[model samples]
Target: MKNYIFCLLAIVLFSCSPKEQVQTFMTYNLRYNNPNDGENRWEVRKENVADLILNYQPDVFGTQEGLNDQITWLDSVLTNYSYIGVGRDDGKQKGEYCAIFYKTAKYNVIKQSTFWLSKTPEEISVGWDAALERICTYFLLENKETKQRFYVFNAHFDHVGNIARLNSSKLIFSKITEHNPENYPCVLMGDLNLLPETDPILYLSMQMDDSKGLAGESVSGAEGTFNGFKHDKTVTDRIDYIFISKGDAKVKEYKVIDDQVEERYPSDHLPVLVEMEL
Candidate 1:
């Protein structure tokens, strides 16, 4: 009788413990829709992009350079996912968006918000010397089964302004630290457009643990993200990244997805994918 009671208690305790959560994150710069892109137009590469996402099925993903129609198309195809973000120009669909998508079946969005990367973060305004308006979108999600919570921040830094990028990094750090005080397992992903040694990158590294740097195994794949629609150009610089809040998650795998079909690539910037445990 005592043995039976002990066994039952052990089973109950095991069931009550929080389940280990493993999630995958992907960051891709869709490369703004432009008629000048010619063969690399959205219509030409969308299916391939969709197929790639469906095949890997990341638990969450952040996208940069996505215009309204482009985001809508992705919304239509990714039936199991829901996204949060606003246009950077007017905060109402007037310009490109940095969108974050998550699997709806696995998690619920408890809260979500967006802010411009400028001095006046509250309004739709450009920051110091930024060439264009930049924005960051964030999602606070709760796992349905485990009830665990986490945050995800998606962004695109200015490509033309050095001061803007530096200040933008500081702004992002401040925002993240303010909102994520509990240190909930959080992930930041985006097309940073800066080299690894840049001030912005270095500052962010101090706040978060990069998946590529923390992966238990060596990162396997291409070293760069931008391809510039040049099939033969060797990609050697990485400007995209997925970073998790320090002490919040464990990096299991990191990959730079550079797959192509028939010499047709999905986007100018390859996707950065990471698997982590919380």
Candidate 2:
């Protein structure tokens, strides 16, 4: 009888204990709704985008350059997921959003916030020489099954402003430290608009592990994330990234998904994917 009781207790304890969790994360730049895009307009490419996302079914994902309408459309079609973000223009639905989407059934939001990448991060304002406003959206989420909590940050850096990009990197790291007081396992992904080995990426690499470099398995897919819709094989400029906090988390695989429908690409940028165990 004592042996039976001991076995039952052991089973219960095992069941309640935290289990290692592996999740897929993706970062994509959904080019904003622009009518002048002609063949690659949002309306023409949106279905392909939806299909690709559904096929991969990332547990969590981050998007850049999505406007209010585009975000709403994605939120509607991607029924299994919900997102958190605010437009950079007015802290509402005015401009592009650095949206972070998570599977609704897998996690619950504990806290979420959005801040501009500027000297005055508390308010909505462009910083340095940026031609446009930039922002970062972050969320603290708790896994429904394991009860483990972590943070996710998504951002879009200025394409024209070198100072803005560097400052944005610093600001994001500071914000991560501020928001994650417990130093929870964190994931930062985005269209940073800076090449690898540059100052901004170098700074970020010091603080976090670039998922591509840390993947335990082989990294695969296109060498570059930006295609610019030009079928130029010579174009190899990788700017998109996924960085995880330096912790117990292990990146199992990293991939730059360059999938396209026929000869047409969904967006100007390819999506970067990572499967990690935390």
Candidate 3:
């Protein structure tokens, strides 16, 4: 009788314990909707981009350099996902967006906002020698199944301004610390426009763990994330990244997807995908 009771209690305890949830995340740069891109124009590559995303179906993803119309088209096509972001130009639908998208059925958004990577984060202005206005979009999300809450920050740093990139890194770190006072799990992903060895990345590495280094043997695909629409296999300038708060999550796999259709690449930059347990 005591054995039976013990077995029943074990079963109950096992059933009641919280289970670890695994989620897939991706960071992609769509290269904006420039008509001068010719065969690589947004209209020409939109379907391929959708197909790639649908094939992987990441639980969450961040995109950079997408115009309002481009974002609208993606929002329409990715029916199961919802996104949060604002244009860098006007805090409205004016310029490029650094948008974050999550699966609507799996997570409920608690709070979301967008802020410029500038001296005046609350206003629409450029900062620190940046060539153009930059922005970061963040979302606090609650997983419906486990009731676990986490934050996701998606950003785009200045490609031309070294000082801007460094300051932007500091600002983003501060913002992350400010928003997550309870030390909830955080994921930061984007097209930072800087290499892995740069000072900005080094600063971010002080507190965050780059998913690529954590994946170990599970890393796959190209070593770099930017293809520049060139078929050269020798390109290895990795500028995109997925970073998670230290010890917050365990990375299961990391991949830099270089999928191309008929020898034509989808975009100028490839997508960085990470699978993690949180």
Which candidate leads in TM-score? 3
Candidate 2 local lDDT, 204-232, one digit each (tens): 99999899889866799898999998854
TM-score of each: 0.93, 0.93, 0.95
How much does candidate 2 score in TM-score?
A: 0.93
Tens-digit per-residue lDDT, 1-278, candidate 3: 99999999999998887653789999999999999998899999999999999999999999999999999999999999989898999899999999998999999999999989999998999989999999999999999989999999999999999999999999999999998998999999999999999999999998799999899899998888888888656559899999999998888999999888988778999999999997
lDDT of 1 at 8: 100
Candidate 3 regions exceeding 4 Å error are 1-20
Extract clashing residue pairs from model 2. Answer: none
lDDT for residue 110 in candidate 1, whole number 0-100? 92
Of 1 and 2, the candidate ranking higher by TM-score: 1
For model 3, name the residue pairs that clash. none
TM-score for candidate 1: 0.93
Which has the higher lDDT value, candidate number 1 or candidate number 3?
A: 3
Per residue, candidate 1 scores C-alpha lDDT tens digits across 1-278 of: 99999999999997887653888999999988888889989889899999999999999999999999999899999999989888998887879999998999999999999999999998998889889999999989999998999999999999899999999889988998899878788888999989899999999999888888899675878889888877777787899999888887778889998889787679999999998887
Off by over 4 Å in 2: 1-20, 232-235
- Backbone collision count in every prediction? 0, 0, 0
